[model samples]
Target: MFDYYNLEPVLMWIHSTMCGLMPEWLAFTIEGIAVGIFIMVMYAVLAIILIYMERKVCAAFQCRIGPDRVGGRGGLLQVPADVIKILTKEIISLKNSDKFLYALAPFLVIMASILTFSCLPWNKGGEILHMNIGIFFVLAASSIGVLGILLAGWSSNSKYTLIGAVRSGAMIISYELSIGLSVLTMVILCGTMDIQEIVAYQENGWNIFKGHLPALMAFVIYLIAGNAEANRAPFDLAEAEQELTAGYHTEYSGMHFGFFYLAEYLNLFITAGIAVTLFLGGWMPLHIAGLEGFNTIMDYIPGVIWFVGKTFFVVFLLMWIRWTFPRLRIDQVLILEWKYLMPLSLLVLVIMTVMKVFGLVF
Candidate 1:
């Protein structure tokens, strides 16, 4: 059954057939473009789904009906309608703005988000780019999106935008250290940077259990820093609605604003995906020692199903945190990073390193 869902073999067969019909380079380019388009469409669809899920989740917590009008029972069409409305709206531009940079910012943000997908292992043999430095590539690609935020703010020529950008820059710089350190802790435990290899290493059990306390601490810090990286509350000082009136994106309108909106949700998914890949075991199934029957039952389930389930579980956790906590002040956000998470993450990394040296990790 899992073999039927293995897309890599199918795609490879298609590529081979295409190569027979045309030049290998041309066939490969066409295949690549097709895959890229599929990913972009998936990203857009996922963003819509996340937006709807968030609204419903927030409404449930607040004792409200959420979206009841569109798409019948639950207003499932709300996001699609909103997308249409945003696309149809006129793009407003201010005089004396850096037109090129202002126009380029949103694409840059979306591009950075999309690029990270290449390194993400969707299932066994399903990564777009199987690079040796998979985890490092993800971190590097993700950090580039901040530049788009900065450009949007600076190019707008608004004081509010400038302030938001500065706050975001400072927040990212502070929190990114913790994120890196936490990820390094996992890398140290796994002894490999290849995302697939890390997942395979967890065939016996997840690192969250195998690596024990150090892995748990790294996961906690990762979640905190990941939320901050995505600019989600209570770390959303970069886009404090009451404070900056939309923050770095205050001057953006129509599709420009939509791009930022889509990028934010995509980044949320990326963070969750990383968490799932690194700590939760990616597509690996649950297996208990001396429980062959149960393990066999788990193996019957498809890898993609397990991967998506774990990723969305983490996504829901992030959403719960977002709605439960109020936005933090810029100073407090920085303090949480530099004063607490950063030092704690560093310590966890050192502990994991020592444990690895001593052969304490399972």
Candidate 2:
């Protein structure tokens, strides 16, 4: 019987087969190109899905029909149409803008998103680049987008963009601490930074149920900080449409603007992916103690399905928050981070560390 649960062996078989016919170096080169293409294709497909999902979700929340007249039922083709429109639209440039930086800014944001996306452990043996410090690598790559945002605003020479970029910088400086602390808390509990190992650590039970209160606290803190870092509402002060008029990318048009838009959604995916891996067990299926039959049935399902299902659930939670809550004022945003989230995160970190020290974590 073909076991869908483990794909690592299948991948190895394919690579071995290729090496038997082609030069070893050429085989590796082809494999790299293939993986690159897979990442790009997955990136575009997910972005399109998220764009449509958000519109429909927002419409539902507001009690309005969304994309009813676009293409198919429920505006199924609306996002694809928008994609075509962006591809064909002329990229408008400001005459006084720093040409080099302005052109480079959008690419920077998109590239950073792609780099972080590569770090996800998609499924069993499905990781593109599973490194020892995968979670930290993701954090570092995600931070690179901050530079892109700042450059987009500053290079454009627009006051509105500058203000938006400044707010983004302040927000990053504040929320990033909580995010790091929360991740560190998990690292202490899990005793490893490799995402795959973290998943393995949850083989008995997920960290949320295993570590109990502190793990739950870390999860909440990570979600809030992740939302803020991704600049999603209600933490979307960086591009408060009513006030800053599109924020850092105010002067961007067409596909340049599209890059920023897509990056926002993909960044959300990366955030949710990490959260799923660290707290929700990544590709590990649910396994309750003393439930042998139930566990066996769960094991029959593919790891990819588990990973994708858990990830989308988290994504929906983030999306729901975006449509339900109002955007925060800049001061409120800062106060929430510094006064509430940071302190809570620090406390959670300490508690988790104590749990690890005392062997209290299950």
Candidate 3:
């Protein structure tokens, strides 16, 4: 039986096997290539699956048939077809556009997501980058996405795109504080910037349960802010279709637009991934305090399964919010962050800090 508790041994064993087959440097090069391909394929598959899932989910929410056109059996192939369509779409040339910046925007967004995913602990031994400042790194990489949006808008030289990009900047700037403060609440409780350590610390109990109401509040705030960061509906003032045509990437077509599309879905995964890692215990299976027998059974399931399941659950929650809630006015969106969420997150952080100092945590 695989040692389900820790798969690092298995990974190391695989590495040793690969090393035995080739020179050390060659093996390392191969592994590096493999990791890059793994990340790319993982996100590509996830983005495609998420796109299909979103269509089906939103269809159900709106009493529509969804993507039932492609394969005649619930349109199972529709998402991929859409991918091909976008991938093949011609890149429209814009008059008087910034050649350098306009071409550079999508790559910025895509690269940010790629960098953020490197530190995300997908499974027991799946994190490619293990920095002590994992939390800070993730936040920093995420912040780069806003610059991409702003540039996309400005480079396009269109009033609509500029407005959309500026709106995105304002929204992200406002929400990032709440997002950071919410994560900080857990950092206080856990006392580590390492995301993997945070998950391991939750082996006994997830932070959402351990820190009492403060953790719960932080989770709520994080969900809202993260959703905003992904530029999803309700909080999707950045890409308000009704107002900005196609928003920041309006001038982009072909794969440039596809890159933005892919980044959006990948951002959703990162948001949900962070929530699962920090609040819901990442890949750790659920266990009651004394249910030794039950815990044993739960551990039999793979950590990757637990992590992906928990992540998609949160993603589902995000999609639910997007389809159900109406988009907020731009001012209302800012108010929700500055006046309400920001203050509330600060309070949550303070309460969590006191709980830790007093040792009153669960």
Candidate 4:
């Protein structure tokens, strides 16, 4: 028999041993700090891999080879080289900019990006905090990034930055309504906001499959809303470079700009993680509920692979949309939210609620 719960104490003991010579409280503190650091490091590694994946995907779509000259076949080390160049570049501050906020903004956004990962249930018995309100916590942490963008724009003291900040604010707020409504619909059906519990609910079948028509429609609405929330095209009104220069961080230079850039990619992962947990079922293997052979095959795979595989699929779709579509104007973005997404989500929520009341879905 495979013993899973038995491994927890062993892992804890190893964690405790790694923080040796420290007081018990200090050991816990160190462990927490280590976990946080590990998350950051993982984000960086994933971002690098995603960058290469995105580059290759975009190249194929455009009929070109992306980054083929750096380190070996596909320039595997290209990301590190890019990082080095950014790290070595000059850091410049504008004469009239607010130094404090300008310097603080990038890290604030980066922190928000990392914080959202804390509540994500990556696998069975996995999560940093394991909170019941994990879904709400993730949403709250993600919203903090908009504030950082606002700070960066105002601190830069540039017209373009101000416009970018304003655009991001309006766009995020509009899209968030639909996103929240869709997520709440899931919470209503699952009867708990705990991510692990949500995952459990999807073990037999994904929510997108279980809830049938209503859940599928909500899933589509969620994806559209999430894309806008992540500032991805055709929803990238925030960084409309052709129109607003470099957008909110117009005056930021070197590593500061790099921070903003990295945070965008990190946000993509975080949003996809949320999507997996809510719709596709985080760490849950796929099964048609009547097929033992298929279920057995899925069970053979580790939980982490299922979780990461679904997340990357979502990310890949987002990249395809980014490369294939034209960017929408700010007004059109608002029209998309106020006119289409919000109404559809509201109607879908009502339909889902009615279906559950009638015992139409499990």
lDDT of all the models against the reference?
0.90, 0.90, 0.90, 0.86
Kindly report which residue pairs in candidate 1 clash with one another. none
TM-score of candidate 2 on Cα atoms, chains taken together: 0.97
Backbone clash pairs in model 2 (N, Cα, C under 3 Å; residues 3+ apart or in different chains), count: 0
Q: Is candidate 3 or 4 superior in TM-score? A: 3
lDDT of 1 by residue, 1-362 (tens): 24645667877898889999999999989988998888988888989998998899889889998998998998989999999999999999889999999999999999999999667778877888787789998999988899999999999999999999999989988888998999999999999999989888888899999899999999999999999999999988888988899999999999999999999998999999999999999988888899989988888888888888898899999999999999988888877888888889989989999999999999
User: Over all chains combined, what TM-score does candidate 3 have?
Assistant: 0.96
TM for every model, in the order presented, reads 0.97, 0.97, 0.96, 0.95
Model 4 alpha-carbon miss at residue 73, Å: 1.6
lDDT of 2: 0.90
| Model 3 Cα lDDT, one tens digit per residue, 1-362 | 22555768877998999999999999899999998999899889999999999999999999997988797778999998888898888988788988889999999999999998788787776788888889889998999999999999999999889999999999999999999999999999999999888988898889899997999999999999999999988888778888999899888999999999999999999999999999999988888888889888888998889999999999999999999999998899999998999999999999998989999998
What lDDT score goes with residue 162 in model 1? 93
Off by over 4 Å in 1: 1-6
How well does model 3 score by local distance difference test?
Answer: 0.90
Write the residue-wise lDDT of candidate 4 on 152-203 in tens digits: 9899999999999999999998888998999998887787999889988887
Error of 2 at 148 (Å): 0.3
For model 2, how does the per-residue alpha-carbon lDDT over 67-150 read when each residue is reduced to its tens digit?
877876778888999999999999988998899999999999998899989988877788988899988898888888999999
Name the 10 consecutive residues with the lowest summed lDDT in model 2.
1-10
Q: Write down the worst ten-residue block by lDDT for model 1.
A: 1-10
State in Å the error of residue 295, model 3. 1.6
lDDT of 4 at 130: 79
